[model samples]
Target chain A: MSLDFLAGFTIFMLALIMVVSMVPGLLAGLESSGIDYDAVAYRTGVILVEDPGWPVYPPWEMNDEVHKDEIERIGLAVSKDTPNILLSTKVETFFNDSFFTPDDYRNLAIFGDIPYSYHFSLRSLDGVTYNEETGDPLPPGYGYIRRVVKIKEPGVAVINGTTFAPQYTSLSSNQEFIVRLDFGQLLDPSVGAAYRIDPRTEPVNVTITNFGAYLNMTEPSTNATLRTVTFWKKDPTRPIPQFTRIPFAYGTTDSSLYTLTIDGNPYDLTPDTKVFDNDNISLVLKPAATSLFTLDQNSILDIRFNFGDTPSQTNITGIHHYDYNSTNVTLPDLQTGVLEVAVW
Target chain B: MVNDAGQLYTMEGVAAGVIMLLTVYIVISTTSIYTPGDTHIPDMQLEQLGSDVLAMMDTPDTNGTKSALETFVNADDDAGFESMFLSYCNAKASGAADDLHMSANVTYRDGNLIKEHQFLAPDNTWTGRESAVRVTRWVQLDSQPGRTTYAGARAQAVLVEVLLWRA
Candidate 1:
């Protein structure tokens, strides 16, 4: 064994040991890829649950197909301050596959470097209100995250004729029932978005039931004709504050914008539907139509229902203020729900 | 062959071999290849879920209304708190509700001593063997003399700590 040969063998052994030690470091980088998937899923979950998304004033959910590129992110939460509290409208818009393509979801919600596949689902505890999902099927191994949330549903103003007949019904020949929405009071800065009623973001539901009490007792008629439903707006900030009729496509029967159902029969805003004594009238004004009206925070919106039956068959005529009064509007409690996200 | 000079080289070779073998053994033993399941993903999920449930419970549904968490703590409604917490935690998107268990403690500063009161007792499923995640929320309470757990006469802030686990 020459000294030169011995030293060469020792150097070879040292090189082999160093290479073996470096093997673990190489494997570590590979193992991190799996963990990275979980990290992406977790980030997507946080974005959907905690964030209110970009372009918040005119919420990202409100963007239509043509303007979809303007949306920077997709989130379900009602507002920035209220995390884990989702808005029903935002949820509906996010899960609408027709409106948003798979690419849109990947770009907005599940932002990842490798174009990772994703699955998102949300179900209300009650099992009826919300059951929505999007994306591809799950594989055997996937990064997953689940968040418990509360769904904030819009309130409905229910005016039972039996309760309001005595106060509103009059002998006046002109019968006009008005439901006033004071945006100043509704969009007050003091009120949080979780509880605030913004017509530009949510639907306005007005239901009047038990019409027998409102029917004129002197007449032998069993029903009254609902001629037209018109919208009027007044801005208090104006030099002379006075309500002017808002011009809209009242003749077009667009259920997407607004829905008017009388006696379980769907009708347009201009429907001259006859309302029976035992029937109910429901008007749902969606946010899409409200946005078309160009209303500001200080604007006052009035939905007037004109009963133009000659020789007036009904006496239902008065302004129904749709304010925060519990008796006028019934705001539902925040419903508990679970939202899950999976990435692979 | 009385060549003592080669002995030093022989000794050096043996020393290098020993060092190399030890390094190989230590690297092989310590460098554990972790499977996806064994990673901290499950812990992160559970911790996030627990934190979300606590946060949602603390938020009020309406602007002026009292949050469910504050109401339960102010009234010392242990049963109500337990049921609410479990309901929120166990709710699922599909299939049967998840099997989740929870135990809670309210920590408040009473004068100089930080007191901890058992707000919710663990159910029978709790065997002390489950991997539980702890989540906490700060709750501000107004002076309520009638409360049994918080006998404080002045307004104070308290921490609601909950240990959550899947049964």
Candidate 2:
């Protein structure tokens, strides 16, 4: 070999060694970005599926537009004890983009150092109950995580005409039907939140079916006039406990607060519509209206339905206690759903 | 000097070649090329999904009712277990269901021996090469008659192990 060959080889070897040592550091830096994305996605998934947001008693979802800043986190799970089980009310509110801006989701759910564009979607396996999506369209390369969950929906109390006719209908001059909700019993600590009938958070659904059974038989009346529906509350904790009429805008038909349907026609709480014997009545009192009642756990709420006619066209005059009895209220099964979270 | 410089030059050349070869070898081994799949992100996602599905199945819709998992396991209903597990794991938020396969086993203590019984057999999708994740849950069983696989008349705790893989 020539004498110069040794000098050239030595220079090449030293340069190669320097480059090789630096390669590892470069690769590690690149690898971290990929790993961090996946880690963030996993963390977000766990937070949403396994946690019940802060201030769980009143629930974070109950915060109105004024108190929105008080909400620290937003979770869909029913409670911390029941992971992968979501509350339908929380799910509904969380996906309401108008109520929760994209910044809310980033600050509450993602909690990453740098802002990340996120996409969240939830779909029920049955394909009808829930199909909610919020956030931007997905990009090709993004961190993703999917969770299997069950959604707990609010139960509905159905007052079957045939079953309650004998108990409620009577030959009295007054035609009044009352559905009593005992908050003390309904919010018992023993019952899990997943199954508890919480009037404060869930909608109070009362449906009266088979109206023909309660019509006046002697007068051969084909229909009865539903004069007004009023809400009354009694606080047993108070020194003098008695049912008093709750002040509300009964004439204003606000679908956001409550929905009163008679014979399949939507009306306000003061629906004076004449119901045919074969018709049905459904009253859905949303949580927004319930929160306005200034009620506590000990308060007893009564939904009074007054039917007015000259000779009492209907004889539905008894208080139906809305308790845990399966006969009165039917709790639907937990619906299966899938939730996906992606971060980029 | 009897041309001893040639021997020294050959020695230098060999040393340089060895040094170059060693440097290349160290660099190649130290700097690993990690593909996206090598990160095991899919495995982590699959495992988490499997565990969540099992936990949700074990929770009853109502307070006093038996969970779907307990009922199926107690009755030795393998078919029901397989279908429910697949339905939960394969469900996607895009309205399109994914294709996932699973097999399960029940591990129980009989006397002093730990025994494993196959609860659900793998379907035709099993090729033995797919990457799979294992998730387990503990189930309490009341004293009952001896069944096909598990034989016990006393209350005991058993572990339900499931192997999940994307098809």
Candidate 3:
């Protein structure tokens, strides 16, 4: 009987030892290691603000749904040179929850062994909500960081009737209004990246107002038929500089790339459309289209607006240089914003 | 004899139980309960926020104009600098501002000695014991004319140190 009791007792002792050995492992969840949450938050802030992020060429922000997997990191700053100055496109992409999954944010942004829940928010000083959140509801005790940032808004070239009326009527009815973007002057190294007009990333806006003033009023009707708008690129670095029409998928209307609005109605650049005078002609060329153009810093991008009618509709002509002429283009001042990141 | 043997077994069991209990007690006690000192997370967070606000202020909004930080530091406008810094730190996405207090000092090298000018004084509620974080920025000044705090009037780089804490 004693021997049997001893065997049972030994078994119980062994079992107890085993349970004791596993206690630390079980308690591991209860007591986390000295990994600082705030340190993780600070690191994340630095990643988003200072670094330009992975795949600098093409930029991670350019990745679409299909190419989403290729993007390793999401950074908002325009470039490493301009810290705390975020690019609007990058900001949009980073906050787009539909494009990026939670796992993607975990792996790409708050990289840690243990997956962390995060809340990121950016509010512009102009009271615009650029982005609100990227994750679940923030818990009580979470790693938090707040950064003050300035957002570099895209510049618009406004060619009103007052500024270009004389030049428009100067040439006879070939009917082409050329708005030239000198990339060399726009991308001058002396100009800081925060304020530089980089066509590769920023949308090019050309808004012509008071169209009636430029119309062929000499013709009985004040309305003019806009034939087709075409993009032409010329590389000044080449020995022979000549403008060549850019080959684009003009057949399909990609509003993401470029949008042409005549009096507020969207229309395809190709084919014939009637442009009424006393209306607005706004053309916004998105960065995606600019990237597809394959133009470099020395290349001059011409946005030619062609008007066609049997007797020639409009007398608008000559190239309008979209430079720092404040009267021609209105560059909005950089607005301040606050970006907060919380991780747990 | 059987009774004696039963008594010995019971005593042995009691001894074993005591040994097991002691082992667990020692193990649990020795397992270090991590103190906050090991991870200065709060301090780190505060430092980063302060630094970011200062750095952002130093950055020019456009290519041509002077930075807000330079203008504030050059003019030695304590109230202006304090208000700006607080606003930048306090403004939140929720449209509600945070409650953060700060004191600032400008440090510049004056010949052989390093001089510190009291840029901003703490408010009346400030106590010496609050856990505060220090953040600094380097501001280059064209000249120190009409300022008796620092020695040389020539162009010099000054360090703007700000001590920030939560109220």
Question: Best-fitting candidate, measured by DockQ?
Answer: 3
- List, for all models, the DockQ compared with the true complex: 0.38, 0.34, 0.39
Query: TM-score of every model?
Result: 0.87, 0.86, 0.85
lDDT of 2 by residue, A1-344 (tens): 46646655665666567667766775664566667778898999999999988778678888878999999988888889878889898999899999999889999999999999999999988877999999999987688899999999988989989888998888874899999999999999898878888888788999999998899988889999999999999999999999999999999998878999988889988888899977889999988889899899999999999999998888888898888998888888888889999998
Residue range B16-101, candidate 2, lDDT tens digits = 66676677668656555544443588899999999989998898877689899988988889999988888888988884678999
Q: Which residue pairs in candidate 1 collide?
A: none
lDDT of 3 by residue, A2-38 (tens): 7646855775586578658868764663334334576
List interface RMSDs for the candidates, in order. 5.9, 5.4, 5.1
Per-residue alpha-carbon lDDT of candidate 3 for residues B1-167, written as tens digits (9 for 90 to 100): 45655556556655676677667667666654544343466677678778878988898876688899999988888889998899888888764688899999999887788889899999865798889999999998877667554445678889999999988
lDDT of 1 by residue, B20-66 (tens): 77776676565555344444677788899999888888888776889
Query: What does candidate 1 score in Cα RMSD to the true structure?
Result: 5.1
How far is A94's C-alpha from truth in model 2 (Å)? 1.6
| Per-prediction fnat | 0.50, 0.40, 0.35
Question: Which candidate has the highest lDDT of all?
Answer: 2
Flag regions of model 3 displaced more than 4 Å: A1-39, A167-173, A217-221, A310-313, B1-34, B144-153
